[model samples]
Target: MNREAFYKLTYGLYLVSSLRGEKKNGFVSNAVFQVTSNPPQIAVVCNKDNFTSQLIKDSKLFSISVLKKDANPKLFGLFGFKTGATVDKFESVKHITAKTGAPIVVEESLAWFDCELINTFDVGTHNIFVGQIIDSDLLDSESEPFLYSYYRDVKKGKAPKNAPTFIANK
Candidate 1:
């Protein structure tokens, strides 16, 4: 089986965040997608080992911040490469607490969605968190969404080990 075939699947870059009490955490993800339209629902796939995953489970809330094409490279370094347990990822970033109490990253984001976790599914190394969209807003009307293809092909970015699309070196 050619793993490279998976790369053909389109994905968008996003920051998935959740708050457990006063502590909030976020990570860069490409596995977020809309699950339904009528009632408005979305799903985010997070590695079971991710700190943000547990936070989302415990809080029953999450926020998705859609990244723009011109998003800062440092945002990926801080949120994607570093662990939130050891680093304060939101310390210097501009963000706001959503109605669901999840942190919405405003910096370098084109849109934001506040969601209430409705269901969860265990999928081996990752957990799929399905949420009902509680509230959402568009921040930049003119900016184009950041795509995973652009991240890989243009920016030459690599997916973290925990990412669903991560391909280990053979």
Candidate 2:
């Protein structure tokens, strides 16, 4: 089985955030996708060890901030490479609390979605959280979405170990 085949699957980059009481956390994810259209449902996959995953489980809410093609590289370093356990990822970033109290990253975002947790599925190392779209808005009408391919092929970015698409170097 060639793991490289998985790389051919298209994915978009996003920031998935959630708030638990006073604590807020988020992470860079490429596993967010629409699961249904009739009831407007989407699913986001998070690693079990991720701080943001616990926040999402506790809050029963989350927000997806769609990154633009020209999104700042530092955003990835702050949210993707650094752990929210010791770092306040939102502290230095420009963001707003959604109606669901989840943080929506405004900087370099092309669109945003506030969601309410509807169901959860345990998938080994990751948990897939399916949510109903509560509210959403477009931030930039002209900007193109940031794709995972671009992140790798152009930006030469690497996925964190916790990411669902992460490939170990052998």
Highest lDDT among the candidates is held by which one?
Answer: 1
lDDT of 1 by residue, 16-113 (tens): 99988888899999999999998999999999988898899888999999999969999999999998888888899999989988999999999999
What ranges in model 2 sit over 4 Å off?
Answer: none
> Quick one: RMSD of model 1?
0.9
lDDT values of the candidates? 0.94, 0.93
TM-score computed on alpha carbons, candidate 2: 0.98
lDDT of 2 by residue, 23-91 (tens): 878999999999999899999999999999889988899999999996999999999999899998888
Go through the candidates in order and give the clash count of each: 0, 0
RMSD of each: 0.9, 0.9
The C-alpha local distance difference test score for the whole of candidate 1 amounts to 0.94
lDDT of 1 at 83: 83
